[model samples]
Target: MVMATTASTAAPTSLSSVTLEVADIEAARRFYTAFGVDTHIHLRASGTQSTGFRGFTLALTVAGPATVDSFVGAAVDAGATVLKPAAKSLWGYSGVVRAPDGTIWKIATSAKKDTGPATREIGEVVLLLGVEDVKATKQVYTDRGLTVAKSFGGKYTEFAAGQSSPVKLALYKRRALAKDLGVPVDGTGSHRIVLGGTADAFTDQDGFVWEAAASPAPTPS
Candidate 1:
């Protein structure tokens, strides 16, 4: 015999897609295309007012330092303002760039040396939210059925978005994250980001909205 589960008892939700709200869709598309991340990130135009740091950043993890340089250079050429120039840190080599659309992006790699020449390859895309209270926000997501993959006190928490999901989710302290991205901590109005996943639609502790999962694009026949 087998048992069936109800909607209330279903498995935890996983992050499926990330949509960034931009003022100009065409311009954003052009910038992302030049930056070589257009395929991974979704963009939509909105008149929603936003200022300063959007309280979030999308990080791209690549193979090595050379790859990091490649991405940073491309992003800079695409009109992205460099927040933190690519440099070797204790944990890895990384750089931060503010997209023309007002979204902050971080390009990083764990390996200090390149095994080979740089290529236009991205390993992981992580959506990191800057929350006022990490512990409370993490609990809210956990209660909403998101599994925690890594946690460290109230400083940081990362959720397991499953292997097949397009984006990964994580949380960090607002001030700390701002310092890491080389931006001011203060901001107002919309976060200007929408997350799509399997979980029921609802806003999180920091006003980040999650809607129903976005359907995958049709394959070429």
Candidate 2:
């Protein structure tokens, strides 16, 4: 049942895991694991504050178009909001889902062949942030010791991937991001980036949130 895609596309710079915060850990895990994502759940007191989409994760290498449909369809079947119906996109066969916890996931798959299951069910997680100012947002990470691996004019940028990085970092303009999500460009609510790593919890200049992780946590919602 669980298998990694056989696509020959290069895997990301060694992503380890991606953790999400959910009020109901079990519900989140059930939804994510339904589609074969390696899911783990941890209990923490729910502070008075709420959670929302702070960022997104996009996986490029997948078994093929059918895999994309299966995963995206599964997410929708699990009560996820279909931000974009599975179809052709800038990347390949792609779609977006707003999970139960308000976390938006952008799942993408290439046209490559599907070999089999990966060590982990899904491929690397590319942490994507949507900001009004791309240059300023790029500076936030560059100042934090993350070097830019690639960048484009006022549209997109990706931080240099590390061997042990939990998820790769990327930035896209707000409008461009909204267009990708097939949503309106409001730039009002959360970007769904409540990510955790080996570092402490901190908020970026654009207000995205990240936390610290001691090890490769088999994390869930």
TM-score between model 1 and native:
0.91
Per-candidate RMSD, Å = 5.8, 9.2
lDDT of 1 by residue, 1-221 (tens): 11122234443477777888988999898899899887776887899998787899999999999999999999999899999999999998999999998899999999999899999999988999999889988887777688999999999999997665777899999999999999999998899998876655777768888777646331111
Q: lDDT per residue, candidate 2, 94-199, as tens digits?
A: 7788777666677777754445543234565676777777897666556555678899977899887666554677888866776777766554454433555444
TM-score of each: 0.91, 0.73
Top candidate by lDDT: 1
- How many clashes in each structure? 0, 15
Top candidate by TM-score: 1
After superposition, candidate 2 runs with Cα above 4 Å error: 1-17, 39-60, 112-121, 187-193, 199-201, 216-221
Give the range where candidate 2 is weakest over 10 consecutive residues by summed lDDT: 1-10
